[model samples]
Each structure stands twice: as C-alpha cells, then as structure tokens.
Target: MNVITDNLGMLGQGLVTTLTIAFIGYACALVVGTVIAIFRVSPIPPLRALGAAWVTVACNIPTLCLMILAAFAAPRAGVPLSLFAAAVTAIVFSASGFVCETVRSGINSVSKGQIEAARALGMPFGLIIGAVVLPQALARTIQPLVNIFISCLIGSSLAAAIGVPELTNVTQQLNLRYAQAVITFLTSGLTYLAIAFLATKLGGLLERRITGREAHA
Candidate 1:
C-alpha cells in the first residue's frame, strides 16, 4: 500500500504508457497484418511470396531482438529512431505476423461459394474481399484477434529494455528505490492481472457483438 501510495503519480504515468504502447502497436499490427493477409491470399505469385516471406522472417525473429535491432542497429545505420518508437515497431512487426496468419486462416474459412457468388455479381476483387469476405472473416476471427491483443499487452512489458517508462520499468525503478521487492512485484503482477482480465472481458463483448451482427447479416 505504501509502495503504491508513495509512487501513485509515477505508476499512473507508467500505466498510461503501457496502454499507449499496447494500443498503438495493435493498431499498427491490425493494418499491416490485414494487408499481409490479403497479399498472402492474392492470386499474384510475387505478392504471395512477399507476404509469406515477411510472415516467416518476422515470426522467426523474437520480439526482443527486433526491438534491439530497431533501437540500436537502425540508429547506427543513420536512421534516427527513438526507443519508444522502436519498441512499438518491434511489437507491431512481431504481433502483425501472428495477426497475418490468424486473419489468413479466417479468410480461408470463408466458403468458396460465397466468393464465386460475389464474382458472378461482377464484383471486383477488392469489393469482394472488403464487402463479401472481410466482414465474415473478421467475425469468425474475433476470439483469436482478441487473444493476440492480450499477447501484445503482455509483450509491451518488454519496452522496459529500451528504457521506455512503461509499467514493468517503473515497477522495477520503484522497487529499487524503496527496497520493497515483494510488495513491488506483487503489485505489478496484480496490476497485470487486472489488465488481462479487462482485456478478456472486452474481447468477449466484441466477439458477441460481431457474432450477432454476422448472424443478422
């Protein structure tokens, strides 16, 4: 209690940073992932190859290594990038790979007949995908997407490595300053638990809404 009481302002700031990183990273991931997923399923061979290669390479590299490379290597090579930006980039790229795969799977689950019907209606590829396919794919994929979001939330803790003032970093600093290791760790863990619980509940609500909409559609 004293640990939190003494550092309430700092902890609040850290929480805000964590949320910022998580949300911004996820938003970036959503866009990049959706694009990659489309490319992965495109009829064009080169696009499919490019998308597959991206997913393979990004998925193979660990998020921490990506963050390190973005933060350290890119700067050394004349690209000026901040640690916070680099950390978020790492989260985006890594999480986007998983999101790409998940979205692709959802797209694949769409019935071939529906796609053929859309084509028969003289729909362009983009309209078919956007209007006839993406909605259904996303509806079917809400749970997996939410799961990925939860993973991204947990991964934001790695921002501490880049000196980002996110939750884990602040907790570690506070613990060092106060020498209350047990209390500090417990508080941090509980905070994370609360965030995770909220994410799960939110995911459930989203899933229900999407499912209902799809059913009506």
Candidate 2:
C-alpha cells in the first residue's frame, strides 16, 4: 500500500504515456492498414505487389528492432524524431501490416454475391468499397480490431526502451528507487491486465453496434 501510494503520481503519468502511444498507434494503423488492404486487393499487379511486400517485410521484422530503428537509426540518418514520436511511428508502422492482413481477411470473408450485386447495380469500385464492402468488413472485423488493440497496448511497453517513460519504464524506475521490486512489478502487471480486460469488454459492445448497423443496412 505504501509503495502504491508513493508511486501513484508516477503511475498516472505513465498511464497517460501508455494511452497516448496506443491511441496514436491505433489511428495510424487504421488508416495505413485500410489503404494497404485496398492495395493488396487492387486490380493492378504492381499495387498488389507493393502491398504484399510491405506486409511481408514488416511482419517479419521484430517490433523492438523497428522501434529502435525509428528512434535511433532514423535520427542518425538525419530524420530525427523524439522518443515519443518515434514510438508512435514504430508502433503504427509495425501494427499497420497486421491490421492490413486483418482487414484483407475480413474483406475476403464477405460473400461474393454482395459485391457482384453492387457491381451489377453499376456502383463504382470506390463506392462499392466505401458503401457496401467497407461497412460489412468493419462489422466483421470489429472483434479482431479489438484484439489488435490489446496487442498494441502491450507492445507499447517497448516504448520504455526509447526512454518514453510509458508504464513499464516508470515501473522500473519506481522499483529501483523505492527498492520495492515485487510491489512495483506486480502493480504494473495488474494495471495492464485490467486495461486489457476492460478493452475487451468495450470491444464487444462496439462489435454489437457495428454488426447491428450492418444487418439493418
């Protein structure tokens, strides 16, 4: 209790950093992933190739290495970003590939009859995608999106490596400074678990809303 009380402020600060990284990463991933997924299904061979290459290469790379590269290598090469910014870039870049795959899978999961019907109705490709396909895909992908978010939340811990002072980093500092190793680590773990669980519940609600809308449409 003493240790928790003493480190409450620091924990609050760390929580803010964690939320910042996750939200930023999620927004970037959503956009980039959707674009790449569209490209992956493009009629143009080159577009498909480019999308596949990005996903393949990024998915193969380790998240920590990517974060370090974003923080250190890019800077040394004169494209400098602060630790926080680098973390945002790293998480987004890495997570985007996964999101792309998820989006693609969802797109594929939809029935061909709907797309064919849309095309027969003279809907443009963009309209078909935006109006008919995307809505359905988003409905199907909500649960997976939530799962990806939970993973992103955990991966944000790597931000500590770049001196971002996210949850794990702050906990490490508290552990060393207060010599309450067990308490600090346990508290951090519980907090992370709690957030993940809460997110899962919220995601379920979102999934219901999205799917209900799709059914009505």
Candidate 3:
C-alpha cells in the first residue's frame, strides 16, 4: 500500500502511455494485417508470395531485435524516428504478422460454397470478398482477433527496452528508487492482472455483440 500510494501518479501516467501505445499499435496491425490477409488469399501469385514472405520473416524475428532496429538502426540509415514512435512501429509490424495469419484463417473459415455462389451472380472479386466473405469471416474470428489484441497489449511492455517509459519501465525505475523488489513487482503484477482481466471481459462482450449481429443478418 505504501509503495503503491507513493508512486500512484507515476503508475497512472505509465498506464496511460501503455494504453496509448497498445491501441495505436493494434490499430496499425489491424489495417496492415487485413491487407496482408487479402494478399495471402488473392489469386495473384506474386501477392501471395509477398504476403507469405512478410509473415514468415516478421514472425521469425524477435520483437526485441525489431525494436532495436527501429530505434537505432533506422536512424543510422537516415530514417530517424523518436523512441516512442519507433517502439510502436516495431510492435505494429511484429504483431501484424500474427494478426495476418489470424485473419487469413478467418477468411478460410468462410464456406467455399458461399464464395462460389457470389461469383456465379457476377459479383466482382472485390465486392464478393468485401461484402459477402469478410463480414462472416470477421464475425467468426472475433475471439481470435481479440486474443491477438490482448497479446499485443501485453507485449507493449517490451517498449521498456527502448526507454518508452511505459508501465514496465516506470515500474522498473520505481523499484530502483524504492529498493523494494517485492512490493514494486507485486504492485506492477496486480496492475497488469487488472488490465488483462478488463481486456478479456471487453473482448467477450465484443464477441457476443458481433455474433448477435451476424445472427440477425
């Protein structure tokens, strides 16, 4: 209690920063993942190859290495970016690989018959995918998508490695100043638990809502 009370402000600020980075990173992931997923499923050979290569390389690379490259190496290459932006960009790109696979799985889960039926009606590829396929795919994939979001949320703590001053970084600094490892770590752990619990609840609620909407449609 004493440790928490003493550092409540710093903790709150860190929490805000964490949430901000997570949301922005996740948003970027969603867009990039959707595009890559589309490419993976496209009839074009080059598009599919590009998508596959991206996911394979991005997923194989460690997030820490990505962060280091984004923060340090990029600057040496004349593409300088701030630490916070670089960290978020690395997280976005890394997380998008998983997200792309998740979305592609969802796209595959849609019945082939429906897609064929759409094509028989003279529907353009874009319209068939966008209007007929994607909605059901997204509805079916909500839980997995939410799970990815949560993973990305937790992974944002890695920003501490790049001096982003997010939750884990702030907690580490506080631990150093207080010299009370048990109290500091316990408090930080509880904070993460609470955040994760809330994310799970929210994800469940969203899944239910999307399912219900699909049923009505």
lDDT of 2 at 120: 100
The candidate that wins on lDDT is 1
Steric clash pairs (candidate 1): none
| Global CA lDDT computed for model 2 | 0.89
Error of 2 at 215 (Å): 5.2
> Candidate 2 — which pairs collide?
none
User: Candidate 2 — which residues are off by over 4 angstroms?
Assistant: 212-217
Candidate lDDT scores, in order, read: 0.91, 0.89, 0.87
The clash count for each model shown is 0, 0, 0
Better of 2 and 3 by lDDT: 2
Can you tell me which runs of candidate 3 are displaced by over 4 Å? none
The TM-score between candidate 1 and the true structure equals 0.96
| RMSD each, Å | 1.1, 1.4, 1.3
Q: Could you tell me the TM-score of candidate 2?
A: 0.95
TM-score of each: 0.96, 0.95, 0.95
35-141, model 1: which lDDT tens digit per residue? 99999999899999999999998799988899999999999999988999998999999999999999999999999999999999999988989998888888888
